[model samples]
Target: MDATPGVISTLFTNAKVFTGETETTFASAFRVTAGVVDWVGDESAATGDITVDLGGRTVLPGLIDSHTHPALIAGTAPAAECFPPAVTSADDLVAVLRAHADGLTDPDAWVLGRGFDDTKFPGRRMPTAADLDRVSTTRPVLVWRCDAHSAVCNTRALEIAGITAHTPDPDGSRFERDADGEPNGVLTEIAAVGAVAAFIPAPTRDAQIDALVGLGEELASRGIVAVCDLLSTRIDDPVATFRTAVDRGLRTRVALYPGWDPVAPLADLAAGDREGQIRIAGVKVVLDGAYSNRTAWVHEAYPESCDHGLRLVDDADVLAAAEWARRNHVQLAIHAMGDRALDRVVELFADAEPWLDGIPSVRIEHATIVSDDYLARLRAARMSFGIATHTVFFFAEYDGYEKALRAEQVPDAYPIARLYAGLDPLALSSDRPATAWSGADDVMLSVEAAVRRRTYNGIDFGPEAAITVPQALLLYTGRARLLSPLEGVGQLAPGFDGSFAVLDRDVFTVPEDEISAVRVAETWIRGERFS
Candidate 1:
C-alpha cells in the first residue's frame, strides 16, 4: 500500500463528522496532514498508513471558549475548592478554608477564596464578619460568592481595608450593612467591592503570565483549543502579558479584548496585525452587572425594590468608546447583562452605524437579559455575539421558576434559542474565577441547559426557549472561533489550523442529561498533540 497520496501520517477514518455547520453521515473518512485536514471523502488512494476506526463515534471540530478568566482558577485556590450551598456547616466551611490555606507558602498573604452560595446556609444566611472571622483570626480572609459581585471579608481583612460603619460607600459599589449602619463585611457589586480591592496587593506581571500559562495547560487537558480571554488589561499595553505567554510557548490560541479605556492601547496592534491565533479582537466595555448578582441594568423593575439596576458605564461613554473603536476598525464586544444595558448597547451600535464602513462587526457579550425585540434588532443590524453559557450555571442552584426568578420575570432573561432562531452569532464560555463557571463543564452541562431549559433541580425553566444539541455545539466551536475571527481556527479543513479533540464518547449521541459525562481523551493543536 503506497502512502495515501498526500496523507501525512494518519487519517482519522470511520468517524461521524459534525462539521460545525451541519451534521453529516456521509463523512466516513477524513485525512489530517501537517496539522490540518488535507481531505475528507469516501475514498482515499493511500492504504499503508495507520487508521483508527471510530466505529461510529461523533467527531467535532475543537471546542472554543469565547470568554474565560483562567487566572482566578490557577491562583489562590485548589481545583477542588468547595463551592457554597453544598458545604453548609460553618465548621465544615472553616475546615475547607484551613485545608486550602495549608497549601499556601505565604502565611500572612491574603487567603482569598471564591464560589460560596448565599442560599445554602441555615436561614439562607450570607456569611457575616463573625463567620469569616472564625475561619482564621491570625490571617485576613476574603471569600467571594460565585457571582463575583459579592464577597464576605473577615474582621482582620475589613480592618486592613479600613471599612467600618463610618466609612462611606464607594461610588459604583455598595457595602451591605447591619441595622446600626455597621459594615457587615459583605461587599456588593463593583462599587463596594472596588473599595476593598483597592487595598489588596496587585499581582505582578510575571504572576499574571504564570496564571495564564497554568490556565492554558489546564484547558488543553480539557480539550479547549482556542479561547477569548475576558481579562482586564492595563491601558498602556493590553496584550503585553498574553504576548509574553505566547512567546514562552503557550499552546492555546488567544483572542484578547481588554477593558475600554480612552487611550486605546491595542488600537495600534489591531491595525498592524493580521495574524489570527494571537490578536486584539476588540474593546470590552461593562454596561451593567450580571444576572445572578441582580445587578443587571433592566428596563423593568427588580423585585427587591421595584428599582432598575444601576448602569456601571454610561451610554455616552459606551458610544464614545464604540465610535473610537469603529473609527479604528476594531470590534466592540460590550458586556451588557441587563435589559436596559442591552438597550443602551444597541443604541450605541446604532450611533456608530454611519461610521461602520471600516469597523469589524460588533458583538454583545452576556446579553443575558436582552428582550426578543432587541435581539431582532441586533440580528437586523448584523451585530454578533449571544454568549451566555456561564449564566446557565447560576440556575443550577435554584429549584423552580418562581423561586429562581420572581413571578413577573418568569422567563429569567437568558434567551438562548431566540438568538439561534434569529441567526445570530452565539458563543459558549465560562467567565472563570469570576464565576464558578468552567469551560470544560459548559460543553456538557450548559448544552443540556440550553437544549432542555431545565435547571439542575429538574424544573423546567423555559423549555420553549431551549436550543438544540447541534446548535449548542456550534456555539462552542464555530461561533467561538470567530473570537479571533481566526481564519481556519475551529473547523477541521484544509488551510485551517490543525486543532482538535478526541472524545471519550460521542457527545451528540449521549442522553442529554449524561452529556456532561463525556470527557476529552486527547487534544491536538497545530497538528501536534498537547494533551
Candidate 2:
C-alpha cells in the first residue's frame, strides 16, 4: 500500500546507500515518509518512529529503463520464446519450434515463436519457409527476428496471408525472394510483417491484463520500478489494456508512446487515459530500421551493393508528427538509428518551438551511429534533444554490425563516453526482446557492456568509449529520469520518490568482467517492500 501524509516514518539504517546526488555521496541511513524520501545521512542523525537495519547491503536508486517494449513483450506472451544462448544454432531453433508445434491441441492453430538473430546463426543464414515447414507443414508457423522489424513464416502462413509470387510487396516493406519471383517467407519492416501477423490470433483483454501483471513481477524482480513502453500500439487499445493491467495489480509505472501512423493515427485521449499510473506520454515514429538487420539508413552504402538502406518515414511525415505533438502538448520521439536519419531529424525539428520547458522537446530513439559532426550539429541546434541508445545492441549482435558497419564507422557505434560528456538526459536502455541477447533487460548486462565495451563473441568493440561504474550508474539513474515522464523518480535524495533496489553483491566493487553477475535481492517502491 502507498504511504500516506500522516504515516509514521521508518528509518532504514546500516546500509551503504548511494543517494544519487553525486558519484561519491554515500549515506548510511534514509527515512521514508508519505511514500517519498524525507532524509538521507549518517545513521546517528536519522530519526523515525521505527528503525530497521539493512545489514550493510548496497542500495541504489530504482532503475529506469527509459526505453523498452514491455507492452509488446506482454502482448506477445502466447508465443513461444526463441531467444539466444538456448536457441543459438538453426538446429536448436527448429527443435524448439517443433516441440511447440507438437504440443498444440488444435492441429490447425498457428505455431508462433519470436527472438532469433540470424547474424549469430552458423554462416549467418536466416531461417526460411522451408526451415519452418520442418516444424509443421499443415499448421502455419511464424517466427520474428530479434529486432522485431521482420519475420519469417512457413509456406502455410504465407498462403493464409494470401502472399504469393503474384503478391507485390507492401508500401514500405519487402519480402525476401528466391531465384524466381516468390517470397522466401522472410518479411522485412512492419508493413510486410503485418501482412502475416494480421492472420495470427491476438490475445483477449483478460489475457493481456494477466500477462502484464506477470511481466510487472518479472521487472520488479530485476529491480526496475518504471519503464517507457516505447511501442505501445502493438497492443490493441493500449490505454484500456494498460489501465486494466494496472488495476489488476501491476506495480510498475508505465509511460505509453503509441506509434504514429500517417494513415491511421491513435484515437483522441479520453478522461481515463491520463488518470492512472499508466498514461499516454508521447508519440513514436520509426524513422529508420535497426543495424542488426542491415536496414538502418546510412550515409555510406553497404560494402558490396550501392544500397544505403531504408528511410521508413519521410520529411513530410516527421514534420506532420512534430505538428501533432505540438497540438496535443506531448513529446515527439523519432527512431533514428542511422547517421543519415539523425541528420534528417535535426533538419525537420530544429526550428520548431517547444510546447514546454525543463524537459527535452524531442527525443531520438537509438541514435546508433552518431558521428562527431552530428554531435556538433546537435549542440548547435535550437531544439532540445535527448537520446535513448543501447550497448546491448552491439554486445548481442556484433556479427551483424561487423558486416554492416564500415571499418571507419566502427567506433561511432554507441560512443558511450562521448555521449556522456556531450548530451544531457542521455540514457542506455536494454531494448529487451528487440535485442538479440537473452535476458536483454537485465541491467547488469547493459552495465557490463558499457564498462567493458566487449561483445558476446569476446571481441573488443571500442575500449576507449568505455566509462567507469559511477558514470554508468548515473546514466541508468539520475540522468535517465530527465527523459522519463515520472517526476521525482530515479534518485534517492530528499523529496525524491522512495524507490530503490538492494543488490545481492557490491556492484561498484565487483571486477569489471563480473559486473553482469550481480543480482537484485530486494526492490522497494514508494516506501513499500515490493519484491
Candidate 3:
C-alpha cells in the first residue's frame, strides 16, 4: 500500500495485529497516516483512503535485535562458511576448506573460513595448523572457532604474523603452544586473532557499504526493522559507514556502540547523528571472553580446569569508557558474560548516579550469569542498567555450557524468566555470526529456545525458567526498544513508527515445539512494504 505523508492514508485490515502497548494487545486493524501510525483499533472503526486485507495473518511490531553485530557479520562474510550441522568433524572441516580454497581464483588470496565447533565433535578435538595446512600451503588460512572467541590458522598465516615460540602471551589472551613452546597456530581470544587478522586487507569502503546494503535486505527477511551494532568501531569509520549504508537503502535502523578506546576515541557525534535511524548511541567495553572457550570470567574454575575465565579489560579502562560515555552524553554498553565480570560492573556502577535519564544509563550486552544479590545490588544502584541477554548462546553452545558451568549454575544460565520479572529494560537478542548456530539471527529460534528452554540437541537447559509467548515477544519488541537509542520504534501504537511484520501463522497458537518453524511472510516499514 502506498500513501501520502500527510494526505493519503493506508488501512491494513483482517489481521491479528499486536500493537505491543496499545489499549488492546490484539487489534483487528491499523491505519497509517503521514508514514506513521495514526490510529489502530477494531477493523469496523478503521477509516483510511486505501484498504488491504491481510487474510487473518498475525502481525507484530517490527522486531528488534538489541545486541547484534551486523558490521561484524558483514566484515567476516564472503569467507568460506565453516559452521555446523554440516561440517561435523575436523576431517569435514578440512574437506570443506580445501574445496573452498580450490574454488578461489586468486592463488594468493587469504583463505578465510569461519564458524567451526570442535566441542561437538567425536573427542572434542580442535583442528590445528597441521590440519589446516592440508587445505593450503602457500595461502594464509584462518578459520574462527564457532564462538568467535578464538581461531586456528595455518602455518602461513602464523608466519605472516611473525608469531613464533618466543612471542610472549598478551594479557588475558594467548597463542596455544606445543611441546617445544612453539606457537601452534591456535590463537586464543581477540588479541591473538587480531595479530594476523590485522594483516588481512581491510575491506574497501565501497565493499563494506555494499555489504551493509545486502545485510539490511537479509535482516528484513527475518522481520527485523531495527538493530544495534554492539561493537561498531571494529570498522574504519562505523558512524559514517552505517550512515552511508542507510542512505544506500540498508533496511534496518542501526544504533552503533563503537568499542571504547582511550587512545583512539570515536569521532564526535554530529548533532544529526544523535537522533536518526543510523545513530551513535554509545561505546562498548567487552569485559570478558565467552563460555564456549572457558573464557567467561566465572567466579569458580571450570570442571577439571583451574581456569576461571578471562577478564579482558581493567577497572581503570572500563571506568574510563564510562567517563567517555558520560562526557559525550551517550550511553555505556558493557559486555559482561560471567558472574565475576558482572560483579565488577555492579561494583563499578553501584556508587554512581545514572549519567542520563529516560534511556538506560548503561546497557549490559550479555548478563549471562546473575545472582540474587547481584540483581538486588544492580536495582539498588543509582545508575540504571539494562540487560541484552541471549538464549541462543545456550542453545548453540550447550556442550560448552555443560562443560564450563557447575551443576548448580545450570539453571542460572540466561534465566530469562527471572530477568523478565526483575529487569525493566531487559531484552533477548541474537549475538549472530558471533554465535555457533547457522541461523543464530532467526528470531523464532531464539523464542523457541527461551520458551522451551531446550537446546538444539533436545537437552533441557532450564525448563523451570521457561516463559510465555507474550513475554518473549516483548523482549523482541516493546522492551527491546529500551536497549536502543533510536526513538519512535518497536511499537505499533498511534505515535510509533509504522513498522511491523506479518507472520505466516498465528505464533501465539503454535505448538511450542513448532515455533522454531514459524516464518515471517511480510514486513512493513514506515507504512511501506519492506520485503
Q: RMSDs, each prediction?
A: 3.5, 2.0, 1.9
Span of 10 residues, lowest total lDDT, candidate 2 = 1-10
- Provide the lDDT at 225 for model 2: 87
Q: How close is candidate 3 to the true structure, as a TM-score?
A: 0.97
Residue-pair clashes, model 1: 7
**Where does candidate 1 have its weakest 10-residue lDDT segment?**
351-360
lDDT value for model 1: 0.65
Pairs that clash in candidate 1: 4-46, 35-527, 172-191, 173-191, 173-192, 174-192, 482-485
**TM-score to native of every candidate shown:** 0.88, 0.97, 0.97
Error of 2 at 109 (Å): 2.2
lDDT digits (tens) for residues 130-217 of candidate 2:
8999888899999989999999999999999999898898866898889998899999988899999999888777888898999888
lDDT of 2: 0.85
Clashing pairs in 2: none
Candidate 3 residue-wise lDDT, 1-531, digit = tens? 233455988899999988777324888999888778988888887678989899999999999999888888667665777777788788999888988888888777888888898887778887889999998889999998987779999999999999999888877798999898998889998888988888887677888899899989888899999998888876777878888888899868898888877566556667776777788888899899988878889888889989888988899999988888898889999998888999889889878988887788899988887767678888888889899999888898897788888889887888899888888888888887788788788999999998999998999998988988888988999888876677877889878888899999888999999998999999998889989
Q: What lDDT score goes with residue 61 in model 2?
A: 92
